[model samples]
Target: MDHDQINNQSRGAEGKDTKADGAAVAPQFSRDAVFPGEVVGEVTDLNRQDLEKQKAAQGSAHFHRLGWKRLTVVLIVEAIALGSLSLPAAFATLGMVPGVILCISLGLIAIYTSDVVGQVKLKFPHVSHYADAGQLMMGRFGYELVGAMFALQLTFLVSSHTLTGAIAFGNITNNGACSIVFAVVSAIILLILAIPPSFAEVAILGYIDFVSIILAIGITMIATGINKDSITTAPWSAWPQDGLTFAEAFIAITNIVFAYSFAICQFSFMDEMHTPSDYKKSIWALGLIEIFIYTLTGALIYAFVGQEVQSPALLSAGHTISKVAFGVGLPVIFISGSINTTVVGRYIHGRMYKDSIIRFINTKMGWITWLTLITVITVLAFIIAEAIPFFSELLSISSSLFISGFTFYFPAMMWFMLIREGSPFATHNLWKTALNGLCFVIGMIVLVCGTYASIVEIAHKFKTGAISSPFTCAALA
Candidate 1:
């Protein structure tokens, strides 16, 4: 069937009544009345005509074009980037055993929570973003709270990309100019790339992004492996570093947590999917891909470079090859970063013009407002990146403060408030109840301990002058 027919069927399905917990009730239309092909065609055509008229009235912008494959690609574009490279440094602190365990286990939990996110989307088709889901759970206050959290998290992600991009440029050019100049360039590029407001449009770049990161990672791994014998004779440990402190350990764990934060944007991405229920496929595809890449990247790179492995990991591959790796990985860094801006832009723009055609962002006014909003977001991200010059610390603090809720506890609360069907003590509900409880506890621990760890580490770095002053021309590596 065509897009119109599929959308018509979706509308028909959604028209049916649902329970308070979002379970489907009896269908509104009789099956016999819609059974025949000709009748179905007529109904679909009428709905299609109505929709086309609405599209023309509103503008040509369309949101529901993403399929499962493309959705998977978008999730990959958002999820795996600097975080993948950061894993080796985390592994250096946590060692192979804990690192691998956290990588795989947290990945699985993220996948499960993302599945819950998808189910909530499927059930409540009106939830266009995470903030909308928050409203469903806690009214206007929750909406504003989650809205701020969502915006801040995405902004932090953009800041991370901005920082990574500056680092990439500095490494590629061997610090050819002021780092602040590079950061400004990065922000401008992010703003330009974020101009397109559609997730489906962004997914097209995800193809190139996927290839760029893979090639960069492969090059780093090979170069590191080749130079391994010459560099370090020390064997990589299976246990945590001997002097690892509580703060250090938690920061490492939070970095790993940061890597699995794909679930944070699932609702926003799914809002544009034509088949949101197929998000299971996307999450599984993304989750497994992330787990394999993160585990392998962290384990192999740390083993090659030992405890001295750097945050981006590419920097550990020797000077010349590290430059090559950064060049290869540049697309992933910017593209992934820009998508975060697009997401936040869409959210704020949609809210600002919810009852107006400007929400579609295809009109002249829509384009102007969209560009303005994204520019503001990019500038804010640049400021944040400059303020937090340390790489691992920024990621750790952001993950601890925001991602802990977005990836873990929020979804756990979602299960209790919106997704759960029956009593938790019921035979079939017991396991899921326990699982979600664990997720909530995990989120809380990350929020509290991870934040403490990040603050402590940052204070120590400041005290010892280990961190570079903001906007300095000093080399990031």
Candidate 2:
């Protein structure tokens, strides 16, 4: 005759499983007990309406399920398409051995940090995208900073790809028609790629990614084997390898860092993946492939063109083959790279404009502004590449700083934060901490040294009146 008796009576009255006769009817429970809201027995019966609402809610979450194969493919494509062309140019500038080593080292660091970030996102599935990660992990400032950085990276990526295409287009077709053909074709390619919202879809991006890698690797192999004579290097002893100060080494390494900095894309790709567990395995495969390709290409370039050669990748691949491949691959690569950049940038942008900014410029105007800015930068890159024969050097140096920070430093710092904030001991085991520490220390050293070397090189150039400014470049005195 207590609470249990009341519950039993109520169930019986509702036809569940108890007695309902008045002779022993347990005390009539208050209407409040029957239903928490209205007065008396006016409360309606619980029926199909409630069940339907629950089902609908559960159904909405189904879209987030991702498949493992799709994720692996996307990550691999990102790594290969971005890494292949970039490594050759970087190695050419930094010298073969140093260039290859720097890429492998930084790539490993970037991969580890990204894994940590992935784990954090998995822990909080509700806040799973890049913008959310930035805000949740680092706060408002972090969100804004990451967004701006991503936007700039996209601009650089598009510009670089466009220029490479333009150069090849010019070289392959007619001499005078370079700029027009380059700009038009590259822009068209970008527009085509822009049709896809997520750009992670396999049909369009996978084709471009696969074809470009094949052509690039095939051309490189053919050119190197066919023209082996061009690749003979001096003995290790008599090599012009004497008197390279620490500054020189640092500057060279910086160029390599920039070339390899495409690590930020790894996170976006990973997050998009259906199964997060495959992230590490996919990374290892891509890293190993990059290491092998870059190592072989660098060695060949060193042997053939040596230090005196500019743009070794282009030269090593020869005039006809390199020109044709770049002519096609350049536009495709640029467009594909831009998509990844935009995804990262837009993700960041959404996080930043949460308040008034969202109200002000969240329409077509914002999209147009971003596109226009990228177009202008593309033009500037064309002019600069035309004027400065050593323009790749400039790209390598500046990009090194960006790559070092985005790929190595930022990820490591976030890992540190996650560990401190009481992530499971298993996730942040001792070996991981040590590895993260090693990556951080090495990345810092590379960043500092790379900066110093770039400064010295610029100073030397200015003294000789080589490049007057961003707008002007003239012969040395």
Candidate 3:
């Protein structure tokens, strides 16, 4: 059968016909077909139909309202954040040429992997999250494993933002309060912003989040350019640092990898798209935007500040301008951070109430559970942020361990196991197979080498008393 025929049969088997009251009326799939491990079961279709009914009943609670533009906005909210700020430091380590090359090349690879993810989602509409895709690829074991990774990675993302927020507050207020207090305030703001569970609703905040980061980065660039002459006259290099170690280099590379990890949440976001096929538009838009922003931010900031550039290039902008940049960037930090909580909350909420209208979050009970879940997520993230009171290492470790799978290897595997149409050795599929092989290799390399580098560096920092004690009031330098 053709692809469309297969899809039609699949849908028909899973009860495409539903009553107005959201009851499944069509014949169910055979037990053998449903449990064959190649497709999702009938229960998922019922849940989906039920969700549609709930969405229709609660008009404003609809989840499938995102268009391509809004999809891009939501992705930007997820992808671009403190990661951009860290690029300058990455650039400083790898030097100008490699930094720019990695920024462009890795971005292209990420775009390809994201396209594969979107294709899988379109093919299997029931795959609402990465974990669901995992189930399709590797059964129940895959489901649980990917689900845990999804939750932890998103929580790690939120924790990174929490850390960024505290740092921003500390810098903006010039250390006026204890760092722990700043962290608590940051967690509260994140919790509040994450209350809206819908991706469409979050996309609204994405506009402000995007503009906030852009203006902040723009201010930093202008400030740094103006102050370059008066600042340190250390010359920037076009090549890697003279004595960069393996650990140092991989840490920098992993930071760049971390920056392109929008793919990790693409499945979740695309699930909310009104036209899922329009994902290509959003993917290209986000990919180009990230490439431009990261390359420019890394190169310009590194050139201006040379080796003295901070991880967050904002601090490289003169003392006064750094504070201003942080002030302007608060929205992106909190809004972006909160969205992670929302994604995780949505996933958990959907799983917890798959058969109930409460998953839609339009009722009293839904709101209560959602609020409680997000609060718990935010608190856990805050604790993690304190436990790892540093920036670059946390990002590198998260990227190496999780983003490697989600962005690179997992999508590559998806293309091979779920999206490919024929044998790998077929003439038509030769180049694509090779490309996916390369992607898998790259992901594995990052997973192994990058993790080792991050751990080694972090351990060294701790051994040398370079990192502050967790939950300390000491100001971040």
User: Which is the leading candidate under lDDT?
Assistant: 3
Candidate 2 CA-lDDT value: 0.55
Which of the two candidates, 1 or 2, achieves a greater lDDT against the reference?
1
The alpha-carbon lDDT assigned to residue 130 of candidate 2 equals 49
Candidate 2: list runs displaced more than 4 Å.
1-66, 81-103, 126-132, 178-181, 230-240, 245-247, 304-309, 352-394, 420-428, 468-477
State how far residue 31 of model 2 sits from its true place (Å): 50
Error of 2 at 245 (Å): 4.3
* Candidate 1: C-alpha lDDT: 0.87
lDDT scores in order: 0.87, 0.55, 0.88
Regions of candidate 3 where Cα sits further than 4 Å from its true position:
1-61, 388-395
**Candidate 2, clashing residue pairs?**
66-274, 231-303, 231-304
Q: Give the per-residue lDDT digits (tens) of candidate 2, residues 1-477.
A: 355765675576556323555244333445545444333443444523443454444422322244445554555555455345444444544555566566677666555665666666566655435445566667998766665666555555655565555555666665555364555576556544543334345324665666776676567666655775666343212222557676665655554555445466655555555576666666666566556765665555455544443353554566787666565566346655556544544455444443322212223554555454444544554555455544545655656565666667766766777544554255646666677677677668766777667767777777787654332322111
TM-score of 1: 0.87
The TM-score between candidate 2 and the true structure equals 0.69
Question: What local lDDT does model 1 show for residue 225?
Answer: 95
Residues forming the 10-long window of minimal summed lDDT in candidate 1? 33-42
In candidate 3 the C-alpha lDDT for residue 105 amounts to: 99
